[model samples]
Target chain A: MTAKPKLAVWKFSSCDGCQLSLLDCEDELLAVAGAVEIAYFLEASRAVTSGPYDLSLVEGSITTPHDAERIRKVRRQSRTLITIGACATAGGIQALKNFANVQSFIRSVYPHPEFIDTLATSTAIKDHVPVDFELRGCPISKHQLLELVSAVLNLRKPVIPTASQCLECKRAGTVCVMVASGTPCLGPVTQAGCGNLCPAHDRGCYGCFGPAEAPNTASLAQHLAVLGQSRRDIELAFRSFNANAEAFRREGNAHERE
Target chain B: MASKTPAPADRAGVIARAALDELVALLAGRGYRVIGPQLRDGAIVYDDLARADQLPAGWIDQQEGGSYRLVRGPDAALFGHVVGPHSWKRFLYPPAQKLWQAERSAGGFTVTTAAEPEPPLAFLGVRACELHAIAIQDRVFGVESGDFTDSGYAARRQAALLVAVNCGRAAGTCFCVSMQTGPKVTEDLAYDLVLTELLDDRRHDFLVTAGTARGAELLAGLPQRPASAADLVEAEAASARAAVQSRAMVPGVADLLRQNLEHRHWDAVAERCLGCANCTMVCPTCFCSTVEDVTDLSGDHAERWRKWDSCYTLEFSYIHGGGVRRETAARYRQWITHKLSSWHDQFGSSGCTGCGRCITWCPVGIDITAEARAIRDAEGS
Candidate 1:
């Protein structure tokens, strides 16, 4: 008898969109279930299978001390751990906490700051544990999720693209919005996987797939300035979903002085 | 199973009317919904077409960086344009698709999950570049991610027939040749049937080639002439001219970009980039999206929906109360790095397809290809 590949889905400080991406595979959900043993998925059911699981999918960022410790346990229990979504891979949106005082944010959001138990900074899963693969996106793409799971199960490398959204736009036969419409877009710098939604709907890219293989963001920024975008606007664009990402972080810092 | 097997080097043109009429009948006969470009509200849109009359006949478009204008061609021939604003995407990953619907019943709660429906289709006047776009997206949706699975996307992709039209004229912004994806449908493997339009003194000739059993089956029902060598030569020459005319500015930007990550040039562009996601919406392959679950009037029922999201929005990066990318500079950096660099680490292909939509749609008209060149030039300087 062959052993079914064990699958586990974990969460942290995130919008749960990436984890939900797994569930969003409605058509393939049943097929996926048939392919693997559902060891643990708290969002789906109360039936939690005990670990030392085959594959563990961790979502969200490390925000609390307990969460930091818990991830270590997860790391020890799982043979292979893959972080999904922007939060888990690059401290997510919560990595914004890395810039500001967490206490102040807690005080502003919650009436009693003392009631909250959190670390000063929200960090990525990679900061604390070794990750086999890091899937990038504010909310990870469902198709990418399926591929990631399949690749891990097969012990093969996932075939995700490493090009910019601009390449995708070109392939789609779309007239250059920046050239044809003079619309400010991040397609040149953004990673692919979102299926070029914004451009199809008559909008520019917002860098949801994170940065591309070799992003010339500064050149894009300068071009945007020539087109009339203010420094503030350029600065804001750099501080998005994968803000803590080193390249993006450095670019944002340069704008602060300006 | 196919009647006429053209060699891999086959090239030809068919009569326009015969091709359209045959496609319409074949689609209707096969339980497929026919959709093609139609003149609607002053722009060419993908809509349901009942007959050949429904297509944009004798209409050509003049497209430049930041502008689009429909022009009358020399002849009243339909399918004269290279591409319209709409692609095959509207039918696949629909703008608004219901992810899951939840309704409360007596016992506890009844949730209804709808699967992606496969709607067979017959798409007419699909250009070579457009085919390349669909093929690239095939990797993203069909192979790379495989999430948001639409039996509809797969069905339409497989079951639906493509009547690829070779571009005889190149728009100023058209760079399919530079990207090496088009002008001529070199890789005929992608399409079931390929068409090249040849213009003579009186009318046009469409050289048709069938690559798959399905295409041959469909072609058998149509009135197609055996393509003569002259017909094939004329068609090939027309497409070649367009390919040569449409050259991308930076041919090796992808590799050059990979070499200069921290060249201190991004700061120059960040000054003016608004970080608004306008370029992404018009792009065909920017597939980054976010999902949201909401409750109706009563909190008892909840529904989940996926909406197109941008990395430019602050809320997109919201963690706890603040955004991770608090500054636009970092956000910009992250976007370019992932597209050209890290994407290689994830998917074996480049994330971009070299579409210049970002340049045209940018309100300030920032050219991405130009930026890559500038950065490269700066490195050399």
Candidate 2:
């Protein structure tokens, strides 16, 4: 019998919610362990195995110079590197720093700004090194994480969708909160994955999954303007979890203090 | 299958507003799970209905671009206003469905296909445009029309019994007349029973007409009176008024959209488009899906699930390296063109049923008819 595949989980600058999603897969954790060697997951296991790992699931954004160097090493050691969550794929909510002065932000947030070793911008793993796949979400969906892992282990392409959240709302038969209640929903331009959460709760989407395949953010922004959303509101909407993402970044820049 | 043919007007009758409850009972008495529109969460949504009291009684919806509200109607009429955001596609297509499951055993992985028996559904208060949407979906998923038919959708659709409601009033967003799909339920549309709610100061009744033999049988069970000439005239007038009120139109939209792929208006519209895909979600005919294989952490058990997907997302057209429609403009153009132009080539009809849910539901109030007209005007100029 062949040896099991070695799996490694890595983190950078994030809330650790994406990695926590893996641990939160309480029912699947044991079975996943049985299938692969949990070589290096500091969050889940104390047991650390040196890499040249079969598969590395990288989470979080590269926010510091050390993280930038560490990711390169991780990429070198891993046969297949998959980025998990918005942080790894498109820079997480911390990417809001991309718009502002990092030095000022550090000084504002921490007492000892000089001690902080950091990069100017929080960026995705793909920004520094190549990624085999990028699973998009704020706190990535546990089901999608499972699917990505299963696909890698089975030697198949993961069938994660690149569609908008609007489809999810429709499929779930949730009434259009935007249309029916005049609520400003971002589902039309946001990617599908969070299972239409905000809309089901009678609120607009916060765009946790980032920009969909071909988001018409400009049209949506204009529509938002018509809906009595201020320019600041539109800018803020585009500057959420996936703010550093190209589409959202461009849209946000368009709405900037020009 | 013999019941597929149109029944004569002899099957048509009138039912008092009070006796409408009996119709709900008769459908429930059968194995069918009756579904109807009910006021919930500040909007009218389709839900399980065992009694007539659950219907959107004395309620009418005011719908426009970026606006919707539940308002009081003239009387306690059950089916008031036009279509809501909820459509029949939800029940037929479903949000998420299991395709198959696999479990590791001593021999190997054992695969079991999903075979959960779905209860027969009786869809009450279905609109004419909604019926057209269902028919469009039928063609898309039916074995004869498409290369591959979705067994789940096909099964659900086959077991569905449609109870259509003829539109008496058109919402500001509705343009079903332009699409020739609504404001009136024609006999050829395949609705089992069609009800035209006739409400005046003096009377509140339904002019019920059976379109098929099964409908005729159901009508026979309910207490009814022969439809008078006045009732027929009143029913005709209601649909005519709805048609007149719906001023929004996109005449020759298919040809216009097909010819103007490079129009600058696409860029203008793209600027405003958030690409959130609200229009596609609210749209009844937009039937795209994606599948995922989920396993237990133990890795012994796995299930393949399919969920609704939209074209608006960046990854929908992702190839080996990157997505084809990378620009928001390209994506927006793709959606509208596919809905209006390409749909005729693929499905032999426009994808849009002129049910302005996309307009009203859009957070930014982007009207498709207006876009089509703009494209046409640009091309002409």
Choose the strongest candidate by DockQ.
2
Model 2, A153-220: lDDT tens digits are 87767766766777777777777776666677777777778878898999988889988766777777
Quantify all predictions' global Cα lDDT against the true fold.
0.70, 0.85
Worst 10-residue lDDT window, candidate 1 chain A: A167-176
Give stretches of model 2 more than 4 Å off: A102-114, B1-11, B95-112, B143-155, B258-262, B274-276, B288-350
lDDT for A209 (candidate 1): 76
Candidate 1, DockQ to 2 decimals?
A: 0.06
Q: For residue B165, what is the lDDT in candidate 2?
A: 95
lDDT of 2 by residue, B1-381 (tens): 114767566667999887779999999989889999988888888899989888888898887777888899878878876888777888988868899999999989999998988788999999999989998988888734456887778778877888899988888889999888878999888788999999989888999998777888888888889998888999999899889644465688888888888888988887777776778877899988777766654567788887676687676787899888888789889999999889999988889888998888776778898888888777955
Each candidate's fnat: 0.12, 0.75
The prediction achieving the highest lDDT against the true structure is 2
Q: C-alpha displacement of B8 in model 2, angstroms?
A: 4.8
Q: What are the models' TM-scores?
A: 0.58, 0.89
